[model samples]
Target: MLPALSEKELDRLEDLLITYGNDYSVLNLAELNGFFTALASSPNRVNPEQWLPAVAGGKVPKFKKPAHEEAYTALMLRYASQVAEELADDPEHFEPLFEQSEGEEGPTIILEEWCFGYMRGTQVAEWSELPPEQDRLLKAISLHGLEDNFELLDSMSFDEHQACVPLVVEAAQGLYQYQKQHRH
Candidate 1:
């Protein structure tokens, strides 16, 4: 099994992603986590080559050095592998790496970026229509992830948004289990 990313390596990876510049739609760390989680839990295996380009928007970034490119790819692969192993070993304990910020009430868990990443994963995986129950699970994620849901989310109270966190987590775990059970 690949070792989990250390804090230092995560910081380095984040820096590398930023270097890709605004021209590309590179995902931030939180979004990458969500993206990898979705792919890892997918019912069908998605080749790394197929999904790697999606990491940097739609095209692979040109690295300054071959070593840099290799390192960047390694970091991403290890991180993705770690996410998969965590879910496979203990789905009940798997957690999305949502960002948190201090709020008037308490720490506010930011779900938008992560949810967006997960949605992207589904798209890249070309997920087909699922059963109603499974679709409901995905909806829990899209509620916060998709841009169209922003207005609805804006209308919700802080507490209401907070309440959705568990639902999203439950949705992720449920999806993983569903894929495991239904894998072709």
Candidate 2:
């Protein structure tokens, strides 16, 4: 499976996002990856008009430098285009982008933030219920997203989700396939 971004690109992208400030800045690199991955299988082209403002917290962002603006736009376009291509060519093997990040709050937090991106990305375009074939994956990502309770998880569930990581990876791939096959 193709990786969404090289380690260096991922690091550079993360740094750029953080420097720019907005929803992108709030999320860690893993979350950023998860969000874009979710959007990869969308039937529609990833709409910069919609996402730039969303990433900027619903307001138009003004970049400090023209170079930063160019980099941000180029990086986002590459992310969307490359992810879709990867999902189409090798959905089963596409690597998850979470490993690029090393956050203090650990995997759970990363998972939670990733879902935030997933949920948000999916909503950027109009969509209905997923196909019956994808129900398991839908439920998995939805449940994972909802796991964002204000309180921290107790020890058992925490380990459970950590162990569930493989399933999450598979589900994400399944989701990519489902979206591709059932395009509206």
Candidate 3:
């Protein structure tokens, strides 16, 4: 019942975070609004298995091999930086992305809808068999105030993970959204 952000919107927000150091109010608003999760689920209506791998590659750096996980993180950060730089210069484009309140002091309909949609979609995914570690990371990304603990990911507090936390998060979101859309 909640409105959702398209995949493109999440990508834009992520880019904003990468450039603005994740401290910007707009970035926080976007995450709090559940833009990323909504975006993840958007493509699933079209294809399930195929879309998972693709968006996973874009959102999280590591999905499969552990050895290359660092490279994946670097790539994600680099992409985020590029996106941030692009977004910073374009006030017209970026302002709307941040514009949840009307007339500068009204209710934030888009943000509220985005949050609701994200929660619904994520809950649906959690009921299924998605990886726990990955789900945690994705939740961090989708929700404001959640941090990505690189230290925890780098070390093995639990079973030795083949994929880094971010990678798993990305892959799980992909799989969850895919399954949600394609399920019979």
Candidate 4:
């Protein structure tokens, strides 16, 4: 079993991400987790510089702070190992990070950010041959209709999002397996 970064390590990393301004949806550790997870599951390696801007919704962040880079590197190493180990063990337990902060917007907002990152990663990798199920899941994630219907989203319950969690995991696990040999 690949162990997660300890609470202390995670805490420090989380703080680092939180301190970094949310230029992209990539500020919080959860979004970073999304970014790394998408990269690992891609069939080809993607350069960070190529896709970081895409994840930011096409906005080039003015700054690439070293501290943010360090924090991101830490999560990448840890999350990639975790993905490999999890795919080898039980993909059923695989879960993306979707952090919930007090007084924050609904959980769906993070879902959009995570999915947005995931889709951007796939695009950057030029993963052209995703199987149908995985493709369906990817499309589903990218079109959650969060921003399209904000008034309803403001009071949306998380139940719908929770229901899709398994599907997301299954798709991620599938992608991981399909890309495993190419990854390492």
- Per-residue lDDT tens digits for candidate 3, residues 1-184, read 1223346654654553444332222234343234334433432332323322333422333235564454434433343333333333441233212224443434432322333334443543343444675456445434422234445534542323322333333543454445445554
Candidate 2, residue 84: the lDDT equals: 66
Give the Å shift of residue 6 in candidate 3. 14
**Which numbered prediction scores highest in lDDT against the true structure?**
1
Which lDDT tens digits does candidate 2 get at residues 79-110?
A: 76776676677888987665424445463423
- Prediction RMSDs, each to the true structure: 1.3, 3.8, 18.7, 4.9
Q: What's the lDDT for candidate 4?
A: 0.61
Clashing pairs in 3: 33-115, 62-167
Q: If scored against the real structure, what TM-score would every candidate get?
A: 0.95, 0.78, 0.23, 0.65
Give the candidate order by descending lDDT: 1, 2, 4, 3
Model 2: number of backbone collisions: 0
Better of 2 and 4 by lDDT: 2
Task: Give the lDDT of residue 155 in candidate 1.
Answer: 98
Error of 3 at 134 (Å): 2.0
1-184 in candidate 4: lDDT tens per residue? Answer: 4468877877776665555446544565665566667777776776656655554446443546876766656554675566546556765566776655444444442465566556656766777766786667675555542355456445656676556566665666666666776663
> Candidate 2 lDDT (Cα, whole model)?
0.66
Give the runs in model 1 whose Cα sits over 4 Å from its true position. Answer: 21-24
Model 3 deviation from native, Cα RMSD in Å: 18.7
